[model samples]
Target: MDIHFIKENIPLYVEAAGLTVRIALIGILCAFLVGLFCSMIRYLKVPILKGMVQGYIELSRNTPLLIQLYFLYFGLPKIGILFSSEQCAIIGLAFQGGSYMAEAFRSGLESVSKVQKDTGLSLGMTEKQVLQYVVLPQAISTSVPVFCANVIFLIKETSVFSAVALADLMFVTKDLIGIYYKTDEALWMLVIAYLLLLLPISILSSVLERKVRYAGFGNTSTVSGK
Candidate 1:
């Protein structure tokens, strides 16, 4: 199965895999931050902000990621918003992942009991203080597994960056296949690269889920009351 070609191209594969991981890592981090802010906005029920966040989540979730990438990479430059291919790819991935993450965290926030909010208020805490000190922490713990799974999905989705010639793992794999005509080997390497990136994330998510469950964070009975 073109073992010789695979051996010869090891360095290329490694470099491509590194780039893929780097892009995914950056995108996931950005997504998490953006998503957290968006979720908070939704939770606060701000007069205008909730609608904006909902629109953003709906727009991003409904569109094809490829179209989003093309718009970022091709369309933005016309308006003088210049970005490199890699930057465009990262932005697109972050925005896409952020939409999903917002929903995940929103669900977590919803799962938080009204009693917890009342408890914070009974302690003379402001709404902001209650959200920051009580709701967010509980929501974060509850959402850990979903966040991890979403991040893993983001890693896989980064393959789409190849379409923009971002020189990520999938891009390099395609180039290798074209050069060596070893489609099977190229695909196998791609699969292995994905496994390397995602397996640990999956395992970590499972561990975190078990920990959260055992810690009683997942139990409705643990919620505080005023």
Candidate 2:
């Protein structure tokens, strides 16, 4: 599979992979914050804010990341707004990912029963305390699988960063294939690069899930601190 060619291009792939990871990590972090805010709004049923969040979630979730990237990179400049390719990639990833994260978090938050919240309140736990101690813990535990999946999905979505001219892994692979006609070698490296990036996260998620279970996050008795 052109081992020499692959070896020679290792540095190029590494640089691209680094850029991809940096952008994905920043975007995912921003998305989680956005999702957390939206999920809280939905969970509490905030009036005007809740509706806005709903619309945003719908818009973000329905549109493709490539479309969002195009709008940010191309459409915005036409209207006097401008961003660099890196900025566009990050924004698009966050925009697309926030909705999915919101759903995951909202579902987790909702799974914490009203009865449990009431029980926490009855025990003299303040509302904030109840949320901090009771609701959030259980919700996070319940949502781990979904949250991890969203993280992986968002990272993979970085493949579209090339649409904005970012030198991400996909961009490098395509560039190599086009320039050298080394399709098989480039494709194999691309798959290996992605596996290197994603496999640890998948493994870590499984470990985290087990840790959550053992830590008694969802256990009723643990919730009550008994």
What's the lDDT for residue 135 in model 1? 90
- Write down the lDDT that model 2 would get: 0.87
What's the residue-level lDDT of 143 in candidate 2?
A: 81
Model 2 residue 72 CA deviation in Å: 0.7
lDDT of 1: 0.83
- In TM-score terms, candidate 2 sits at 0.93
RMSD of each: 3.5, 3.8
- What are the per-residue Cα lDDT tens digits for candidate 2 across 98-155? 9999998877786688888999999999999998999998888778778888998898
Score every model by TM-score: 0.92, 0.93
Q: How far is 12's C-alpha from truth in model 1 (Å)?
A: 0.9
lDDT of candidates 1 onward, in order? 0.83, 0.87
> Going through the candidates in order, what is the number of backbone clashes in each?
0, 0
